[model samples]
Target: MAHVVSKSEMRHVSVEELRQMASDCRESIWAQAQAIGREPKIYLHWTAGHYGQFWDDYHVQIDEDGEIYVYGELDEILSHTWRRNTGAIGVTLLCGYQANTSDLGPEPPTAAQIEGMARAIEALADGLWLTICKEFVATHGECADNETNDWCHEDYGPRTTCERWDLEYLQTDESPAFNPWAEDGSRGGDVLRGKANWYHNQRG
Candidate 1:
């Protein structure tokens, strides 16, 4: 399980600084993923509440060898799945309140952050054979059949027609309202922006 940073801990850091940190973290995660030999896929939750709110935790990807594929803001991860974050890296951003709504008052991740995350997921997928829905069901139970619309419900099972958050959307660039950072300036904006270039350069 990846360690989630707290809001108090992130209070003083500048967006630029966080961005650099996110970059370094992503690099480390990618290297770890490569070493472990598993395709990396990250699961993100809007723990901080609604669009435009800032997040304080996130979940990351972990390779079979225990290598963590870290990406996105650290404060967005609400909690870990039953599988102990094993074979998957979990990251959490520190925003949002106990309520499901953003009324608690934290900014969500920015568009740039979301884009960066998308790129990272793409890279990890390209490098490894990823099974998003299978892993999600194995760990978090199937989405409810009709009880709750939450993707984490157990009844939903392996979705064949409907797209499960784990399997379909996270891997695609078309995810709805998916912003990777909280309002840009709240944390790590610059780093997320630079990740693609960094990744490209490193690949070369």
Candidate 2:
């Protein structure tokens, strides 16, 4: 089956506005999740563009200062991931332009962007009734790294495409230099999931 392209255009919204929108659509999203053949997943990404540069491919985008942007409905089938767009929601950080395998470029992801994305993920998880984990919420790099799996198609990983290293090395207190493979237990996706889980627990 051919992948359907997304018609979502990036739209800026205040944090409060985003929350309100999520609350308004929570029931519908949950219903969709409960339906058979529906498995909600969130995919993290980086725009590979300068800060504030928005892309239509992703459903949500986080900016350098932690601002959030919505491109389309959470239930919409977006063209963010290859072959994994069917039930995946795409969230991205607007950074990493001109990034290469050796370096994350002039506009590497910032602390604010990471935090913003985490909060967004938490809200989405709550709405979609999803648990924050590698299987449910994965980074683009992680998915690309799963090339051995049947879900992954084509070579689009750091070692292969060399540009799929979004959030591969994230800045953390233990590893401020953004070490690769999370040698210090601060892999980008792990950090985001940890934060999102904390947020979820706090709500209980």
Candidate 3:
């Protein structure tokens, strides 16, 4: 059984290092996005458990402390949710938040991973020349006609738990300060805008 790692257990990776990794790995996505003119308007987060128990499920795979493995480009429209994938750059942490609920274990993201995600988010946003905000980080997209009319998009989209309880979304002072060994299953009461927005402010 894979154990959920503590922050201290996670490997450390710098923003520059992670950025370089993504640049080399997902170069195709950036290139294709440019060629196709599909201006990325949103950033979507996910834990996105894999297919066939392998790690080939994500464009980027991030370990607890920001150690990341990048593959492919952003052009591949396949990802955690459906409609949200249309105009968004999808980010998935390998922390495994969306795994079977009964199999839930220590799979939340580490502090450094959260920080790294912040940097990555800002990096992608800059590369895409996007305006970062919760509204655009994700907003309701129209659902399919065949889906339940009982479902209202205003409060819905698939992968609602993509970024569950990750503290990178909280304001620094209000957020639980980083503790390398902390394991708290939070519900992201207020989206930290998440790491994406956090790192953006650093430049502001």
Candidate 4:
């Protein structure tokens, strides 16, 4: 029988510690997923809360200061995304409260938070043998975009009803590029994936 991990075992950690934790738990997570006959995928999100806020729905969270909080095990299911919890590792950035289409609100995603999430992605992808692509790694907005992805159960996203547009427009210092896949190419899942890929190569 598999050892049961408590859902309440949330812990605060730094970015480096998060990478170490992912490495330490790699084999167990992979074995558990195989035991359950499921493929692991990563789903990124924003809490829509204050910078220091934390949520129990997501397995991992990165705060405005790049502090990481682990809420549950990688293979443990959490109610972060609608209809996509099973075999899904949910990672969220705590920011975007009171955000709108034209505004990112006062507590927008910070550079540290974005880089932290990218590093977390690199660690998790390395542990899970996942490809940093749309099929394996996606944002809540992408999952909500029914037109582009089959992950959505309803018509909602920045391109649709404009709901669940978490991480739609990231706070970046670079000039953004417009693309058909996202409202802006430099602010979508591609950016995170690109950063994660860069980290992977740099570290390798």
Candidate 5:
């Protein structure tokens, strides 16, 4: 079977390919989970804050260079978000979404990577029967939009500043960008939930 990836060049990757990448990064992810002492069930996607840097803090990880990784014990909620870690799953994209310069890095995520991201979300959403939730969306990352100053102190739910990717751009048929994830959470959350719902509806 061939992998027909979308024009995310549109950046990102295939979920199956991303899963294989996760297998490669398993050991480190296990080590991170051991140190954090958390368990999760909900899926949250993220990217490394720096370019060319991949970490096991999240269950699954992807790099700007288009490398994919999976951390062990992903089903167990880890400590990415304090209050939100109770029943959550976390995935990280290697490049920063809102951060340009040293954040997004010289190379941003590829179309395949983003496509994989959506697929991965759909897979998990179907697996867990997750409802529509903006657990991954956060305005902590760098953005020209001063829409909301600061994370509003968990009042919105989380204080993490790494949710820089605008996934909304990927949800539409419009051309996807290498640096397209959003911090609004709502924008990107729709894509995540939409895909998940579609998968669920299809299974029926």
Candidate 6:
């Protein structure tokens, strides 16, 4: 069973308050796992660049044998990672999907909650001098078409294109100058590409 905490339950909490709540929640989770004779292993600390949107709720996946694996963003209020503190803010939704159902029910997070999260993320990014597109690209590698070669062949199969700028393009003169309004705007592409090339050549 998926457990979702209500927005109202967290609406009143400030960032500082939320941080405290996260600490409590983590402690409780650890205690419960220990009580049930399960060992806890956290694979990743809050990393920046991975946006915790789309899925509004945190989740614990339990296998057929009842082995549980927890996955989701740990609220920055509770975590001390650079990503959590200076780049990303966690927003949890209050509903869970059934194990087999790809479509989780309509337990959409409130507008206010979404807006609050956006504001928080913006503030964090501003503090760190990071933009949303840069963050996305950094976390997810080269946004190439999954079905074809890097040449972007569409006739072969479905093309997987990223919505943001492709930083890799800026590495060579083969890529055109960036235009923010263009369909393929290479926003920070040149800067990143140049930096990467310089560093690589320096090592050489």
TM of each candidate vs. truth: 0.34, 0.79, 0.53, 0.82, 0.50, 0.26
Q: For model 6, how does the per-residue alpha-carbon lDDT over 89-198 read when each residue is reduced to its tens digit?
A: 33222222221112212332233332333333332233223333332212111222221112222321111333322222222233333333334434223333334334
Model 6 pairs in collision? 19-77, 56-93
Off by over 4 Å in 1: 1-41, 47-79, 91-105, 131-204
Judged by lDDT, which candidate is best? 4
Per-residue lDDT tens digits of candidate 5, residues 1-204? 112122232233455554454454445444544455532234444453454454545655555544545554555445554444444566555554454322334445565555555566655544444443443322222221222232323332222343333332332333233232444433444555565556546667
**Which of 3 and 6 is ahead in TM-score?**
3
lDDT by residue (tens digit), candidate 4, 102-128: 677899888989888998998888767
lDDT of 6 at 198: 44
Number of the candidate with higher TM-score, 2 or 4: 4
The better-scoring model by lDDT among 2 and 5 is 2
Worst 10 residues of 6 by lDDT: 41-50
Give lDDT tens digits, candidate 2, residues 61-158: 88899888898786677788776776568898988888765567788878888888888888877666677888888888878867323464666766
lDDT of 4 at 159: 69
The residue ranges of model 3 lying beyond 4 angstroms of the native Cα positions read 1-39, 48-54, 97-104, 139-191
What order do you get sorting by TM-score, best first?
4, 2, 3, 5, 1, 6
Better of 4 and 6 by lDDT: 4
Clashes of 6: 2
Candidate 2: minimum summed lDDT over ten consecutive residues — where?
1-10
Instruction: List model 1 lDDT by residue over 45-116, tens digit each.
Output: 323343323332344432222122334543332345432232344432222333222122334344444554
Give the lDDT of residue 117 in candidate 4. 92
Model 4 misplaced stretches (Cα beyond 4 Å): 1-9, 14-17, 23-38, 146-152, 175-184
Residue 79 in model 1: lDDT: 42
Which regions of candidate 6 fall more than 4 Å away from where they truly are? 1-91, 96-104, 134-204
In terms of TM-score, which candidate is strongest?
4
